[model samples]
Target: MLVTPVDNSEIVAALDAALDGGPAVLPLSADDPRAGELRVAMAPDEPTLPGTAVVVATSGSTGAPKGVELSAAALTASATATHARLGGQGQWLLTLPAHHIAGVQVIVRSLLAGTPPVLRGGQTFATAVASMTGPRRYTSLVPTQLLRLLDDPVGLEALCSLDAVLLGGAATPAPLLDGARAAGVRVSTTYGMSETAGGCVYDGKPLDGVRARLADGVIELSGPVLASGYRRDPGGTAAAFVDGWFRTTDLGLLAADGTLSVLGRADFMINTGGVKVAPAAVEAVLVAQPGVAEVCVVDLPDEEWGQLVAAAVVPVDPARPPSVAALRAAVRARLGGPATPKLVRFTDALPLQGPGKVNRKGVKDMLRGT
Candidate 1:
């Protein structure tokens, strides 16, 4: 699905055919330099797939090259469950890249609901919402987009007009979530990945038919929404999907009420000396401070501690930013000394990877330079 021009006609047709048990489509961004390599990895030349509908390439981001094979049944289940969870069918606004699973699910939901999505392309938020004709309106966004939009009165109003706003793709700061809801925007925090055909968990609870469990502190998801496993890597599939559950890299705590509180990515934990700390735990404290607009916490190598906690912050006031000592004290006071960032760098904005996700690797590199 080369969506440079936001043309979904061909992609939609392919999806329709796939639903009818046709050849599986490999959705890739035309702008990605890796498209050719990804295409070779997820061979679309196959005449037909017994059950697969789409193969979303999930390489580079994690570790190795592999394709996520989602069956039509899984996609349909996700779309249907989403609609059911969000209180009936509605029009969707495509704000994220079409190649990502989140964006693909928006189109899939629209397709299953028989109501096509309105791509935000180059239009203003108000203009995009005005063009939507569904009785109910909904859109998905990452935390970065939500924070920016909340600062724009028009965007805030446009979001407030929607039936529900799905926020995911990254960890949302407490301030951002509070601000959005305070301004009358119905925000639903989503959790899931391409393995689950998009977000199967919304607002800390699993969608109807979806189940969440913890295996040795790691989050595991199950239900009809799970992908059929990686396309070509059976070993990877076996490692991830065990006993009808898809194991995720995210660590979480499932409450008695079944509400899952994600504790950030297991692989993203920063190890300083002997104690391990979640970057998000420190970010939660730093982001709530007066001058902090956004923050990304990472670990930098150190001769003494082995690893030193570091932070890159985007200040609310660039000229008069919060003092590093004050920020460190705040984190230390709230989360203890090991979680406090020893090195801090201020920037106008955090580097973004996909649509609205902050690029942590890029932030680490920037902090390293300082």
Candidate 2:
């Protein structure tokens, strides 16, 4: 389903065809260079699972993209479990691009509820939220979207009108969540990826029939909602799935109360002078600082320390960027000296790879002026 230009009618049609057990629909981003590469990699006559529904391409920030083949049963299980957990099915407002799993799940859930989602393309979020009319309204968004919505009074009010707002796609800073909840936004922090068919865990608790376990600090998910495997990549599928559990690159801890706390991505860990630091931890602290709108932390090549902690910051006021010393002090107070950014570069905006995720690699290149 070549998802481009954000066409609601085309997305709905493709999703309907997939739900009916047609050829596995592979949704591609219009701007992604890898879209063409992925097309060539996939066999024209490749055979998928009998009920294969959708094949979502993983964001290839770390490496080559892999297509996650989700079956109709998996999609149904995900939608059913989500609705059951959210109290009941309701109208969903689709603000995210349809190529990603989060956006696709909204459509699936809306279809299950026998209603079309309020398509919010080419319209301000405030306008879209105001147009929604339903008894139980819900929408999923990334932390960045929620942050932007909070900046507008009308958007904030419109957000509060919903029964629930799911925040996912990236790790949300604690301060942001606190602020949203304080503003009465009914925010639910979610943890899951495309492999688990969107967010299987809401507010740290696994949804119905979904199981969360930690294997040496790595998160492993298992349930009916799990995707079959990566299309046309047996090795990638085998590496990610073992013993009926999908091993995620994210490192997390499952609490005694069964809540999950994601620390950060294992692959994203930075080694600095024999110490390992999770960039997300430092980013969380920096984002909470005053005058800081966005931040991306990366590991820059260094001669003395193997790799040094560096940060690319987007200040709220470009004319007066946040104090570098103050930013470092915040991280030092919260995460110690090793995690503190050795180099801080202020930018107009953090480079973005996808809809709402910060492009760490791109930020690193930008910092180097490459």
Candidate 3:
């Protein structure tokens, strides 16, 4: 069954059907045009795993959206491991779109807890969170949402009230995490994607039964929580899932204390004048600058450097934008000269793709036009 509506009743029904092992459920965003395309791609006689419970779409950094076939076992394992990691299952406040795995996990976790998640829509985050009841409370949000909540006193108070908050969908800035901690918010930074049935890692440590390893510089994950494979995309599946490990494009470092520090995606590396620079590393530095609200670092094609480091910055105060020279100087001082953004553009806001992820490709395209 294909479900697109964001309504609570619709989502609950879909979840129930999937858990009962009836028809597999495909949750699509109400506003996503790719939903139709994915349906067409699935066709009339698409083969799927017998135990498939949910097919989540992942378009990644580029290309057509591919349906990731997650089995009942995988979903249950994820939920169980999450609860174990979080101490116990609790009431979840559903704030994210249900189509995404993180959002779906909230409902699955709630179901496992023998309670219904408090549905939230159109209400201010503070009010919605304040309305939640039950002894143990939890919610998941992206960095964007966390940033907004931090700006609101009531929202920050509501956030602090929760037992735990799972922050994912994209890398959480260090400064943002530190600030959230300072506010007494129990923030757990998560790492994983649709293929892993949401986050399998909480705060850099793999959950129970989950194994994380570094193959060269790339991150590979293995365990019971992995998806069956990409639906009807064998070639894609083989490339990503190999030898019982899901090979992620992200590059990471395994610390001595067994913590994982994600550098960035290997594909996103900017090779300029013989030096390879991780955009994420540069972005972290840029985001720490005063008056910078958000930033996206991309590589602009250049004849001399192969690709020049460029940044699109959203200033906290549009009228008082930070100087390009000062920003470059900061980056150079912290990282190096090559890592400094050679081309800096100011924008009102950075373009977002899915669930608050900065559209790096889109930013690069915009810079190309300029």
Candidate 4:
């Protein structure tokens, strides 16, 4: 949820009203007009769905909204484990949009801590931290959100005060992580989705009630925290989960220390000539370049290679667009042969869906008929 106020008082009033309904109310962004347009009429004798305290809709960057049913038991288990991991819950500075599971987790964790998270003004992350009512502060942010916060000195300073900062939603840039660590922020990169009740894996470690495994390079999650299953979408539910393990589209590796390192989504794999390549692996290297801020690698049809590996890049330095040859050389230097992108394209910004995830399909279309 993206909270926007036509009047400031209304926002406060809504929060107050929500709190009045329940001391543990999770206040979320109700600003999207489309959210208001959704209507659910109750029947006089309709029975409630079993085990559903809340049903959060998935971000649907890939497809349609998946109503993930979460029981109070599941949410409580997640929040309790999270609190224990962070040395008990403190005042949370809500940053991510409320509609997201990540944002929802903040409220749930705060409620479990017996204190509602404080809402900061929509201006900056630092301001949000400053607005919090007590000590032992925490916040969750996506990589893009974290990058925006880095732009402000005050925000960076405020971030350093947090006990732990959970970062998730997509793969984070290495440079950004380095910047956060350099600033003395307790950053924890997490990996999980709506099905696992937000981030069950924090900083590569699976939390209590969360289990992770890698079978043939694909990440499989099995735990009490996993959603009862994707709501009503049988085909999707069947395709994603098997034998109690949620077969994530994302690929991962289990280190000897038992930490999970998510590689990239298997769906994003591309075939160049006869070799299979993960575009995200290439994008990861591209983003590490001196001038590159963001990047997306996709496979396009080619007369010679069957599929030409191309990179859509957003350079941090506008004056210096990394040339095709330079990018190819960089790829060669970092990851050789099949992993290197052949074509490099400079873009103002990679097409993002809602948050900062690269829209691969959109990028593919953008490169089409060129």
Give me the candidate number with maximum TM-score.
3
**Residue-wise lDDT of candidate 1 within 1-370, one digit each (tens)?**
2111224556666666776776677767777788777776666664323478888766355465577888899999999999998999888998887777898888888777778888887899889988998878899999888888888999888989999999998888999899889999999999988999989899999999999999899999999999998876788889998989999999999999999999988998988989999998999999999889999998888998889999999999999999999999999999998898989999999887765667777888899884
lDDT of 3 by residue, 1-370 (tens): 4434445668767887788776777777657767677666755256576688888877555766778989889999999999889889888998887888898899999887887888887888888777777658999999999999999998999999999999998888788899999999999999999999999989999999999999998999999999989888789889999889999889999998778889988989999999999999999999899888888898988999999999999888999998889999999999999999999999987778887778887898887774
Per-model TM against the reference: 0.95, 0.94, 0.96, 0.86
Worst 10 residues of 4 by lDDT: 37-46
Ordered list by TM-score, greatest first: 3, 1, 2, 4
User: Once superposed on the true structure, which residue ranges of model 4 sit more than 4 Å away at CA?
Assistant: 1-49
lDDT of candidate 4 over 1-370, digit per residue (tens): 1122223234334333333332122223466454432212111123323555545666566775565656566777887888888887787777766656777777667766766776555656666777776557788888877886787788788988888999988889889899899989899998888888788898899998788998888999988777665545567778887888888888988999999988888877878888988787788788887778878888898988888888888887778776767778888887778878877778787776644566777888877733
- Which should have the higher lDDT, number 3 or number 4? 3
In candidate 2, the residue pairs with backbone N, CA or C atoms under 3 Å apart (3 or more residues apart, or in different chains) clash, namely none
Give the candidates in order of lDDT, highest first.
3, 2, 1, 4
lDDT of each: 0.85, 0.85, 0.86, 0.72
Q: Provide backbone clash counts, one per model.
A: 0, 0, 0, 2
Candidate 3 has which clashing residue pairs, if any? none
